[model samples]
Target: MTPPPLAADTHPPTELARVEFTALTGERVERIAPISQGWGHLSWTVRTTSGRYLIKTGIRRPQQADLYRQVAAQQIAAGSGVATPIVVAVGTPDGPLQRPCYVQTWIEGADAASVLPRLGPQENDRYASALGRQVAAVHRIPGPRFAEDCAATTTYPTWQAACLSRIGRLAASIEEKAVLPPAVLYAVADRLKTLTDQLGNGIVPRLTHRDLYLPNTLITGEPAGAALLDWEAAAFYDPVWDFVKLGMWVFEPHPALRAPFMAGYTEFEPLPDGFHERLTLYQGIEYLAAFPYFGSAWPDERMLASFRTLLSGWMDAHGLVGARP
Candidate 1:
């Protein structure tokens, strides 16, 4: 998969970010530069008189509760022995940022995406394994309920309910956009309804990174020393939901490392029965959701052709060719 353009020339440092960083850390800012920014948040690498920190403010108004939850998620990951940036402060930003923001101690590392291609076979395997173990450690932390968003009040009582809510929302978006063929959308949605029960019986609500892939990970010090980034999307859900991103976006693109990564994850929790089926179900839903999310952001033919390939492959794998749209 093509990498998103780096936030090199964009997301220039703003006075609001600088002001908020100073207010949170109580240190005079010596230097501040943009790290990266995406749909949800704007991030910067800051050096203060006392120390360096990562200051991230939302692109628009993010819920104050979600801000607290992001901090909670980061703290939970750190407690699980996962290397996330340490949170310093989290709260409502004064202005211009237009939302709640947080500060974290800056970690020194190169993005795992940039570093992976440079490694030898052994080094790649070792890094993937280390990352797997770290992810599994975080999954061991349990939550009170299953939620897509991190807000406590919005959580669903059952894993099935949460899964259905996610599926319903994505299906609605795709229908509204009318980008995907109705037949393709209906077939996946129907198959999901039949298979959603599989998720119900064995799944447990655990803290999930929600977004975990090479781009969100950092290789620090050594390839073995890694850190998971971007906890704003973190939530309490089935761990396999996280693997949808890891397997499809990460492992599928880098097939050679999938085994080592799983080897490390299975060290913590063995793969459950019907793991492949559950993964396939989530992946189909993810592909459907991408239409609404990426339809405008990505070029039309590129997006449609990619989806046709992915969905066609999925349908073919499950003997749905006779049912293909």
Candidate 2:
């Protein structure tokens, strides 16, 4: 007998995922429910008779290769003893959903973003340290080439070139959105270009979880260990980019995590030279990008306002708010 289709509201055809899961594991699916949905992806927590699993799929047709890359990165991290989810199956959905999807072992944990604020100082530091070590391990693995996406085959000759290209794209995006005034936008573009030029060449691209942040980290275990989630944004790029992301998304917000995290990272690898300068440039780019990147859906108005204030102070600190290119 044909099973009743999964809920219509569960986008990307959770029914297909259920069928695929059953076929793969020979386990009867008992229940499935959407757990998270955003950024063009929908995730469902599926409970089988024996266990639970996570099925993540995009709302639109996904690049099959990209899905593979995501799984590959996750597997690599897992192999390195990092606590990433184990992949069970991945492929294009053979249904109306059309998007690529993957099923993996479900982890019972709270998002570090929500959990960190409530933790005691010692516990927070421990999780932060664990996260740092995990990040360092990921960086130890080399990538295919210098590109933003793990699945990207394109290569850039120099780190500066790759960085400038990315900055250009961000500038163009913000300009298109008209998030900032024309004068301010032009100056900011020039400042970014100047900063990008300062980044020298011969940097090797390393595997990086480009979206590492408290929200993307899952804290599990009795004492609460940290595990990375969401490998969709993994990439081959300067490791400094990951540091910049962590600085903005983690350290800046939760200042206490900074010292322990940095300490843990240095356990495997010392902080890269010129790290602070690179961080400043990258932070400026990210702060500006946040406007269009988060859009109206930004959950925290206070945070958004903080970014504006931060951006203004950043430009002033660099003494380039209206400086020429």
Candidate 3:
């Protein structure tokens, strides 16, 4: 059986705000469902008098609105043929009216997470391969504009230095949360050395989405086409880095989706020589460095668990810790 569309009322906002926003957009904000309110912003969907649209507003951490990230996202989205919300409004230093808020067309569909559970073994593999191919397409985007992270993504001049800098950032955030196992902190640092020892010299760099999680990819009506959204992390880097992030959640590489996705990837880029080995290293480095991005303020249990699990995977690849064999 098919799953029902995500109920529109997932996160309804206040009635008064709805009236005001309606006047603001010049379209009746019939239903304003709050989506997620993160660090400095809140997102709500407006079933307007005319059509459906998404409205994201900046709150406490309002400065994020003016960042160059949207510019990067706009460029990438244009090249990738993906769906993205255009910047509708941005705030000034004054207040809410001046704060950054975006409104764009609301796509009616489900994310990969919702559809994954319903797929058959073969279907899952097919979708994975499709995802892999799409990722390849995203990597091939041409531009020298994102040179800053490009070199870093290709190969580390000094992996140890890079690793330390990364861990220092994450550790700051980890410390803010509940007591983290001292071993986990130490283990995160120690594993970096092990991965660095095996690091290869040169790597290919390309424009990478940086964060292409399942939920970020949208599947549209009946014939279901894939569309990647959320470009806040867009930058030039090893395209493989995108795949590493997408695949990390799979414990053993999902029983259904692993092979086809890899095969599909090879068709486009011929998978980097020693792709598996390098990808493993990239995954570990990326996982540890990302801890703070997600766990900085929120001491969420799940976030910490994911942090450990990612580390464990890293250890498995390098024998960084005492033998698990």
lDDT of 2 at 232: 77
Task: After superposing candidate 3 on the true structure, give the runs of residues whose Cα lies further than 4 Å from its correct spot.
Answer: 1-33, 36-41, 47-51, 58-62, 65-67, 83-98, 120-126, 142-168, 171-201, 221-224, 250-253, 290-296, 321-325
Candidate 2 wrongly placed segments (more than 4 Å)? 1-16, 24-26, 37-40, 59-66, 96-98, 222-224, 295-304, 323-325
Q: All predictions: root-mean-square deviation over Cα?
A: 4.4, 4.7, 7.2
Worst 10 residues of 2 by lDDT: 1-10
TM-score, predicted candidate 2 vs. hidden true structure: 0.84
Q: Which has the better TM-score: candidate 1, or candidate 2? A: 1
lDDT of 3: 0.57
- Deviation (Å) of 123 in candidate 1: 2.0
lDDT of 3 by residue, 6-72 (tens): 2223332456446545545677666777776333345677786678877655443334333335445
Please give the CA lDDT of all the candidate structures. 0.76, 0.75, 0.57
lDDT per residue, candidate 1, 13-106, as tens digits? 4676787777766787888887563555678878877788887765532566657778888887887778788898774634444447788987
Selected candidate, larger lDDT, 2 vs 3: 2
TM-score per candidate? 0.87, 0.84, 0.69
True lDDT of residue 292, candidate 1: 76
TM-score for candidate 3, please give it.
Answer: 0.69
For model 2, how does the per-residue alpha-carbon lDDT over 21-113 read when each residue is reduced to its tens digit? 666567788998776535545777889866889877654325666677788878877777777899887746453335567889987887887
Winner by TM-score: 1
Ranking by TM-score: 1, 2, 3
